[model samples]
Target: MNKNIDNFVPAEEPSKDQPITVLMIEAVGKCNAICGYCPRGQGLLGPETNTYITMDLLDKALDLASSGSNHAIYLHHRGEPFLHPKLDEIIRRVREKGFYTFLSTNLISATPDKVKKVLTAGINQIEMHYSAGLTRLPHEVLLKRIHEIRKLNWELRNFGCRLEMNFSLFGETREIIMEELSRHTYYDETLYVRWFEPHDWPSLEKIIDRGVDYRDCHWYKHKACAILSNGDIVICCLDQFSHSCRTNIKDIDRIDWESLADRRMCQGCTQHVEMNWLEEDAIDMPLWLTRKQEIDTWTA
Candidate 1:
């Protein structure tokens, strides 16, 4: 990870006085799906503890976040948020506190009733992840599920809920996934195509048959900070497993995003790599110029 920081320029320092704009809470530490690359699925985090974030902790985190500025709260990190029993209540409470809420799920447990409950609870945005390479569910079945949620979103237009689909590109499903993206009409405006990142315990050769080397990326620190289920505030979501990179959430306000160690960790993340490229403007080529139009058309 340290080797990757060589070419990376640290992101501009954030103002110490400014409030955090994004906060990710690991609402739960367990997930229902056993994806090949995730820490939970690979047994790196051990058997499901069935842990859920208590309302008290949620309130404290919200208070800390609210003290600064208008922020967005991501209700997940490593776990299946829907499994949290109090998911609806969590969403409603977060909304009541005036923070925008986002949840990402595998959509395996997203029944019609469950979907309605969350939308009514005021989830500003929900993202569903689908990976043909890892998911046991059939492709057509997942596509149907996507359509169901989109129809539900249309019906609840008054709430202005947004939906997004993320497809993790892999060797076995690359062509089919692209075909689905190009041919299918998504109800939401953006479809995220992600390259699988390599992790420990999940044999790299098996997980990433082909993908970019993200060792030198450094963009996460500028975006958000993650609060793990154990209440440790890590530099970013990708560094959850590294204890050396964490501090208690109580110390969040004192930590610096541009610290040398944090920068090194960010330099090794794939999400940071993707975000960096998305923000870069080349001399002979302008990327952001077409990013919006391309996304709009793809979503449309």
Candidate 2:
């Protein structure tokens, strides 16, 4: 029984009538924090990695993506995107191409001047990942940073942009997190609580014990492409974690989508299974509860 899962063939590509709605660009691969649940923080990624995307390559990616119809461009993947010196320029370029721009950060680098620059750059949305479970900052410190960011947003008249806080829920801290969420109210702002995925993290056992499953994930079915900082392209953002799924951005035009669908990695990923389940109304519970249930067994 040669049951090595990695050797499984890819599945057939489904029909894709719509243009890519999301284009995720990895602007940088370096970060200031070492969260317990992140692969980068665990030192799984090498130090020699290209820390930032080059301007020339960014231009090419933007040109290629803009040539088609893209709804939004997310300028992050696995690192502190603010570390990129030309982040403002990147956002401005995306806006010039007539696509909404989004960036997620820990807010450690969100100085008042930098916040002003980001707003002036016309970024359409910003997500602040301020979870105590995922960062070194204490809960109170993170909340203070969030307040400061909200203050900055208010000072800029809300910048006509969307601001969101992404909190990763843990069993031990869930109640406290809920209380914190209740205490904070921002006009027109959104809040999200996400399950912490223990990808290559030391806390895999703890997270798995808390009822997380990684099987039959269908996020690849979504119409989106990820461009890594080094100009490599992957069908899914999680695919970047596995080298087997990566293809050069230049070869994107020649990629065989059907074959890509059949990759063993794609077949085994459960990254966005909850989103897929939600699409089908198969899981009737609230989004958070639906995700909390183990993926091996869940139905509408």
Tens digits of per-residue lDDT for model 1, 1-300 = 123443455545554564443367778877888776776676676553446788877766666556533345788877778778788888888878876677888877777778877876777677788762236666556666777777776675442665767665444566765666455454232444454544432332122323433234432333345666656665555554543233555545444554323443332344544444212321112343334223231110
Q: Relative to the true structure, how large is the alpha-carbon lDDT of every model?
A: 0.58, 0.58
- What is candidate 1's TM-score against the reference? 0.68
For model 1, the run of ten residues with the poorest summed lDDT: 277-286
Q: Residues 207-276, candidate 2, lDDT per residue (tens digit)?
A: 1233333233443444446677877665655554534344555555533453244345443443555444
Q: Give the TM-score of candidate 2.
A: 0.71
Q: List the residue pairs that clash in candidate 2.
A: 10-262, 10-263, 11-262, 217-270, 282-299, 282-300, 283-300
Candidate 2 residues lying further than 4 Å off, grouped into runs, are 1-11, 16-22, 67-69, 132-134, 139-141, 157-159, 178-219, 244-246, 250-262, 276-300
TM-scores for the candidates: 0.68, 0.71
Error of 1 at 225 (Å): 1.2
Question: Of the candidates shown, which would achieve the greatest TM-score relative to the real structure?
Answer: 2
Q: Output candidate 2 Cα RMSD.
A: 9.7
